[model samples]
Target: MTARTVRGAVGATLAAALITGVAACSNPSPGGAADAGGADSAVVGIATEPESLSPLLGYGKDGNSKIFDGLLTHDAEMKLQPALARALPEVSADGRTYTYALRQGVKFSDGAPFSAKDVVFTYRTILDAKTNNASKTELDAVESVEARGEDTVVFTLKYPYAPFAERTVLPIAPEHVAGGQDVNSGDFTTRPVGTGPYLLTGWSKGEKLSFRANPGYWGGEPAVKKFTMAVIKDDDVRLTRLRSGELDAAILPPNLARAFEKDGTRTTFAARTFDYRNVTLPTQHRVTGDLAVRQALDIAVDRGAMVDKLLDGAGKPAYGPVPTGSPWFTAGTERAHDLDRARRILDDAGWKAGEDGIRVKDGVRASFPLWYTSGDKIRQDHALAFASDAKKAGIEIRTEAGTWEVIEPRMKTDAVLAGGGSPADPDFDQYQLLTSSLGGDGFNNMARYDNPTVDRALEDGRRSGDPAARKAAYDTVQRELVKNPGYVFLTHIDHLYVVNDRWEGLGTQVEPHDHGLGSGPWWNVESWKPKQK
Candidate 1:
């Protein structure tokens, strides 16, 4: 959840409530209450409430990217497109093997089929270590995958990765029914099976989830045949159920997208290639393990008044974890906001300034515990505007919320709201959020931030199979994360949604970082229809 911590919580209460009204809705006039010619069935609507439907233990990309289908997908300009693998693997003049081909008559809305032994039983159940899979360290350089026949599927690599085709957007599963079971002891991860184009059907966990359109999809059936989601974690009850229409599509909050565009409804907004929001830090905490107090709280926050009064201008800032239209971002690097150079870098590190204005030294007190995820009213307005800009630089933050099962076991002793993104590449969002021993001990680095130049630029950007040496090793790991700031860049959002003009193929070629509701705008849910006056 980036954009400087999702606008210090819902972009400053949607720029203090923008409110406009009537953006679009004349399309049905002639004989309204329409459904005339057959097709218009679309139902999309979301605002969190999908913690898992098992696209390999889901981690929010809005309802497991619509009942799962990866093996390559991201298109609308975020590139790396392919889906269910038909191309984009090849390599092997000794780049340590890696074939992939399979795309024949795909199936699986339980009609089964989709082979290559379901991509070698979904990368050997995510490189089994008792299948605990949270992308087991992003497939830890697999040593094998086999199959080589029913539509081919090779792999082999223990080395030459080059982001192993962005870990083929993962979602294969089936080897004649999830091979030898124990995929992390499952009720089949709360019932799952893939191939895509929507399928789930029902769920109540939390509140709602439902879907339908698969009819043995090989890329055909879905034209929105009933897809409900509903898990409303209250952003004012998801903009009062999208302004009482009970949601035709939601996710509001840019001050309710100008009050649902003056209560009429259309809102578009875009930007999101995912950096949602950040503020991590932790690098072995103790008043945030000083790196000059995390570069003086990243030069004393502010990020252009949190993108013009809490993101009504949407969002942009952020300098590190890539995202500047990524191709490995980095251009012209600069990050400032001074506060007297953040109080002369905490008065030359001696930290003083106490008596309530915060900043103590030996007896501690700069303060920590930001965390988030509870009722998330835009991360409680970005944790009360980053605790009023870290209490004017002397620090003292404090705000916790909870439930990523109690903030994933206190992200290695606090600092939350991470929100990442990928339109399919930058090594599938920086090798699953900065690789380390992964899937074990303090996962997703929750700011444990170890760096040997970001672990040798994530192991030479995954074994550089040349794309200009993996964009000069991810532009030298985004300029060594802006000279070692280690998560705090924040702001890169754009994703708005709204939709109610009877849904005509809502943003299809897909990409603004696949804005979750299932892999960004429901990854072309078999070409959305719903407009038949």
Candidate 2:
């Protein structure tokens, strides 16, 4: 459940096919990774790169960090599988205590032994207030983590958090390597040592992340010996590189993915994801802060048309973070695209249309700047479409494009075309998104949404272990959004990738919103094998 509030705003190129490792090629030009490595190496083109490689700083927090192993990991079916831990943790009767038996003889890529102490250090350091991890609150259920001898570790929870076991998927860092230095700004942040299938060789920010398979990996060494993730921010540029053979595989938007449909050499893989694109309505802004404006905008947007046109039938219209097909979704919570109802709501709220056809209320025009990350064609299309839809309802929305650097500062008062979702559990995404305490806390609540009822419901949903109780709690949260809409949810997009059909064992997972880095068809890249000639 790594919500991509910051990185989502950063332009990302999607993943396409199984990639062989590339040598360090920051800019995608001819003579890159595709030429350097043979069949044993693979190179992939992705849109974005992580800010830090360190697990301590929220990298791999949702599992599948290529450089590190978590206590548990999700399989192809999105089910939990043991990694550092020998098996699933033993839960207590009260559901407040969890005990894990460490997998013995496992060592980090740097050749250091992995033990219960390493687990303790990772959890303790992240939970520390001084550590600048924005995701520490996800572990708020933890009361204490104690090491039992060298082989066992135990976690005590403050409440019977139902998804506490899921949270254990967080990657563990070596205590000896990360503990001695500054947890926030340390060499380990860039050069991390972990017990995973690969080792980080180099990270060229805004360019590429280079990796080599760990020879001494606990799970046998990868068949693809070298791997490089070329960071190409523009979708068209990524497609160009992929077409020219500079990239082996890459994630592309649905419209762009169609270009390779007739190409026999490449196969397109469409992964079902919980990724939703929504517009953040900042509560601090005079226009977006109004309940009437929020409700009208929510209903005025045509989500079905967006799915049909922008996504080209690759995704479904979204009503909220929980997809309509999801069992957790409330049946009656879907918002209809009713232009008349939207006009009536605005009219009743005293927003009168001027001679210019723009709504004005009490000398303030119903207009605000909406920002999307520049160079992202998908986001640009969504922003343009949203602005067009809003125009019909007498509202003037000015859509702008900028990098996250320019947009982050204005998020408190301006709207943003934001994307985020998690397939794990409702609590995984909803708690951080809807909690009142997390408002304006660095991307936790980008809209600065503060609703007491939704906040209470999120707390109850996460704290309770009972399935019925959690369902009812989340139902309330969704229902309350209908009455007081904070974000205009657009679509739940399926991740589409095109890849060179060069390897076996290539598949996709039920991905989160934050894809490209640890998702796409190459999520299980370690298990991939070169196809026989």
Candidate 3:
């Protein structure tokens, strides 16, 4: 799974055509004009849209990609299930080689026969240096991928990577279609053909993505024929559209989801997730770079209060990237909210209180700007609360709001309220987030954290096949984060979604931070059957 920047909480700047399309749709209720296109259609409002629909550019890498199917797919329980492959891959004793027997008679949406060559092409293209897949590093364990005849694909690894099987959940692309064009900026990036149940009909960028069921789907065609994902960025707007029968479902924040609880027509679903929101204290900043200031801010903020008040009890305090409920989480690494301890740490480090109560060390004020994306209510609230908490410890934090374009460049010297996590494996997120070599490499390590001990531990955890050894290595990484905290880990949020109760088999899975697209209650939408009236 890719550790992508959480850019979901969005702005509502839709095109006029999108507005007309949404307004024309009616939901299942008395006195309504009509459903989107009757019961066979579904219009959903999601906050963010993918930059590209092509799997090679890193879309649907975690599965549930309506437009694409991975070699393996996750069931409702999130367990690995065969999709493109006939069964689970056969692993060699050394855990370095994996062989998958391709499913017979499966074809891409364009009628191209799915075979071992397509599988080999997809992996090789992603690993190519010219291709700009940011999450390509996740597949660094692959030494080679080859096809034996038309039915079998084999992957050899450089090391004994324990979670190599989980990485195969990556969606495969057709070699016949994608191989002939420019891999980076081809027509396939927008209009894609895959082995998945849904086919892309149209994509109005920043507005909506339209899909129709693939009748030739190997798994069986979806009952819901037409699926339209409205790109309404604002939370309030999404709630309005859902209420007005313009949208059948929408992913909402905890506060917005509360409004639908009393409505008999709609049902709210909450999915437990590894998604966490944290403040990136950039190591290049004069004040934040100080170990004392970083340590103070880590314990000073009230994570419990953020979960209670901001999240409205829809989440838990996150001590690190690993959720406290997860077995991977190490005990005794929890940080208590201690204002006195925070102040003392700053004071002992030669930071003295100025006349206005702000701390100053070596004539430099302990103040830095903190930015969150505009129109994101949850992030804005968290940033404000963080600034307030830091004030109590004699540190000044100035909170700001901007788009990612404005915030990305300033990340090296300023703080950002960013989000990321993956339930697939610890190495999935931790490696990209903490590795020293990944620092300043486009959202990989926004804080530029460079602890040599942590770097070694992360490598050991990902390379070792032994379960005990992996656990011990990750434990060391978590403990070291306590001593030299790079990011102030906050609340691990549970994704909340509101949908009309008109379909059976509609439920949510444990989601990643990059939800809405491949997550929410509609994760298994293809399997859903309309409720008999």
Give the winner by lDDT.
3
Single out the weakest 10-residue window by summed lDDT for candidate 3.
8-17
lDDT of 1 by residue, 1-533 (tens): 31112112232233223211112112322211222122445444565543344544433322236666767755555456667778877879868787878788888877867878777776766666554445455566778889877888888888876666666676666666556554543444446677787766555544556667777778777767766666566667666655555556656557766665555446454535554567777877787777777878776887777767677767777766566765567686658777788778887988877888898888887888888888756556666676677779888888878866567667775777566765545665675566554421433556767667767777777776767877877787777766677677666666666667665666633233334455435556567676677
Give me the runs in candidate 3 sitting further than 4 Å from their true place: 1-37
Ranking by TM-score: 2, 3, 1
Number of backbone-clashing residue pairs for each candidate, in the order shown: 28, 20, 0
What's the CA RMSD for each of the models? 17.8, 4.2, 4.4
| lDDT for model 1 | 0.63
Q: What ranking emerges by lDDT with the best candidate at the front? A: 3, 2, 1
- Poorest 10 consecutive residues by lDDT, candidate 2: 11-20
Estimated TM-score for each candidate:
0.36, 0.95, 0.94
Model 3 lDDT tens row, 188-240:
77668899999887676667778889999998999999988888889988887
State in Å the error of residue 109, model 1. Answer: 15
Residue 27 lDDT (model 2): 47
lDDT of each: 0.63, 0.87, 0.87
Number of the candidate with higher TM-score, 1 or 2: 2
